[model samples]
Target: MIYKALGGDGAAATVVTAAGDARPGPAVELHDPLELLVPDTEDDYRLTVDPDTGHLGFTSTTEAPYAILKADPYLGARRKQTIPDPAFVVAHHGGPAILERTASVLGCDHRQLRHSWDSLRSQGNMTSVSVLDVLARTLDDPDGPRPGEEGLMLAIGPGVTVEAARLRRT
Candidate 1:
């Protein structure tokens, strides 16, 4: 989705699967009702819940591969602080408060975070596909980010996983 938002064909991005224990366990079945918790801290962490699908995701920088990816020079060089406008933010839209907190953390204007809400409002939560839906909505916006602009893509999943990318509009 980030590649698509950046005007790429999604060809360059590599997909790798990681092995880990993410099962909620016998005590807490995957179908059990759950609430996401995000602590107040400086860490890059986020929790998202899809009320419609009853899916809960927890992501944090402490996770090894994502942490390593965040540290990679190529990706790290494009951190939010380095972007001029902070105009594009494609993320899982768990709810209003999470979006607000994300905007604050990214130093992005609340208006820039509208795409996610628009997606959520219009389509409900689509789980892993939510970020892609948000990206599609962003692309459909007439006044959206233009070529050469920078953006961020964030997605959280069952591994308490976080997938992020920095994009340069093409």
Candidate 2:
């Protein structure tokens, strides 16, 4: 699905899975403020507020930069996974700010990150399908990254698990 989405002509492109592992579980539960919570005296669970702060979100300002800084090691590790000098990066579409921050940390240009934002803007968040959607858009673009270029594909899911792959355009 990802290969086809990324304009694999069925002639050459290759997708190689990197690491796949599930974390134990989240120590905290994220809650929506608008949702009512039943009062529970038995269980002690920390309910974290949704990070989405709407128009006044910290993503555009402080949080994203801090996150990028904190994620440097992880990014470096991903880069070290045998895929050298990837020219493109396809990540799960969180939001424009987060995507921009990720691209900045990855040393990707605005044009490379635009397809993910385009997918977000045009179709909203498609959850698990978001990265594929972005890949489809990238493949559809005439001026998108081309053959011989290497790329990295990544997605973060529940349990703070990440799925990543290395690809070489054919």
Candidate 3:
């Protein structure tokens, strides 16, 4: 029941263009997008299809939460090495616990992640669109990143992959 409650359906879209493209009102300049598959944890989280019904399903092993928790060290290291002190954080709505842990590692206060929490509450976990949904919400937020401010986006996926990107509002 708890797991089911954490899931929700949603869809979102965004515009992407080259650096030299014409400005579309305001835009986010993307930088340093990194996707890293955590070693030895590939099977921790997975998607499966029911053979009889052909319905897709999600599964996680007992080690899944622990494996995810272990990402804090990597997150911290990356923060120090490359990630800027972002004014906003648009992250996947994995769950409240995961969101809390991510904020802790990234040194983000609750306000910085308010949009992510709101997205999770209203839309559950929308898989691929989760972060995009959060980003959309962030863009509409009155307190969201201002022009010239930096933002960070984060997501975890099937391969136990951690993807991070730097976004600057322009």
State the C-alpha lDDT per candidate.
0.53, 0.53, 0.78
The digit string of per-residue lDDT tens for model 1 on 103-129 reads: 655566757778888877886656667
Give all TM-scores, in the order shown.
Answer: 0.52, 0.55, 0.85
Question: In model 1, where is the ten-residue run with the lowest total lDDT?
Answer: 25-34
Q: Note each model's CA RMSD in angstroms.
A: 15.2, 14.6, 2.5
lDDT of 2: 0.53
Better of 1 and 2 by TM-score: 2
* Model 2 pairs whose backbones collide: none
For lDDT, candidate 1 versus 3, the one ahead is 3
Per-prediction backbone clash count = 0, 0, 0
Best by TM-score: 3
Per-residue C-alpha lDDT of model 3 across residues 1-170, encoded as one tens digit per residue: 34434454445687888888847675688888888888888789876678999966667887766555667777777766666577888888687887887787788899888998998898778777899888888888777789988888888887688898888887
Segments in model 1 whose C-alpha atoms lie over 4 Å from true places: 1-85
Model 2: per-residue Cα lDDT over 6-61, one tens digit each: 22231323243322432332111111111112232112212123457432111122
**Residue 41 CA displacement from its true place in model 2, Å:** 25
